[model samples]
Target: MPEFAPIHLLYLALAIVLEIAANVLMKFSAGFTRKLPAMTAIVCALAAFTALSYAIEGIQLSVAYGIWGGVGLIATAILGITLFGERLRPSGWLGLALILGGVVLLKFS
Candidate 1:
């Protein structure tokens, strides 16, 4: 297989951002009761998936998915804590750390 290019990583980054935005919009959707946020969330999620598909064309699926999910989870958790007044337990912090480490390893592998 050909080595991954910088553009693939950029696509992955875009995917991650869009995914996070989708998640936040979904939260604002109030169980899909809010039409605008709910619809926008769906659009953002579809776009994110499209970007992820492009990223996987160059990057290994495992690495691309690992980083995509790990970073998305980490960022969403931070947003939840800050924007939603959510709290994470000590174990949750540890889990986030493990996820970060896994993403780092995947990037270098």
Candidate 2:
């Protein structure tokens, strides 16, 4: 892999954060009935994709996408459970664990 500037990693992290915010906002949007949250979610999702684009300029696309999606999925699921009183079955937890493992493998490979 080519050397990448720290900024690229920062962009990837920012993308993940934005994605999480977008997901939370979308949940609060109540299927887009809530105008403010829905609009904010749209903005956040767009910004997240923009950040991901920037990140891929330096980071490998596979690596960046793996990390972004993996982290976002985990964070969203945790938030859903804690904030929304959502529950995941045993298989769901296993799926998350597998995703985490895949991310780690992708990063190292």
**Among these predicted structures, which one has the highest lDDT?**
2
Residue-by-residue lDDT tens digits, candidate 2, 22-74 = 99999999999999999999999999999999999999999999999999999
CA lDDT, every prediction?
Answer: 0.96, 0.97
TM-score of 2: 0.96
**Model 1 Cα lDDT, one tens digit per residue, 53-107:** 9999999999999999999999999999999999999999999999999999888
Candidate 1: the clashing residue pairs are none
- Model 2 stretches with alpha carbons more than 4 Å out: 1-3
Consecutive 10-residue window with the lowest summed lDDT within model 1: 1-10
- The regions of model 1 sitting more than 4 angstroms off are 1-3
Per-model TM values vs. the true structure:
0.95, 0.96
RMSD of each: 1.7, 1.1
Please report how far candidate 1 places residue 24 from its true position, in Å. 0.4
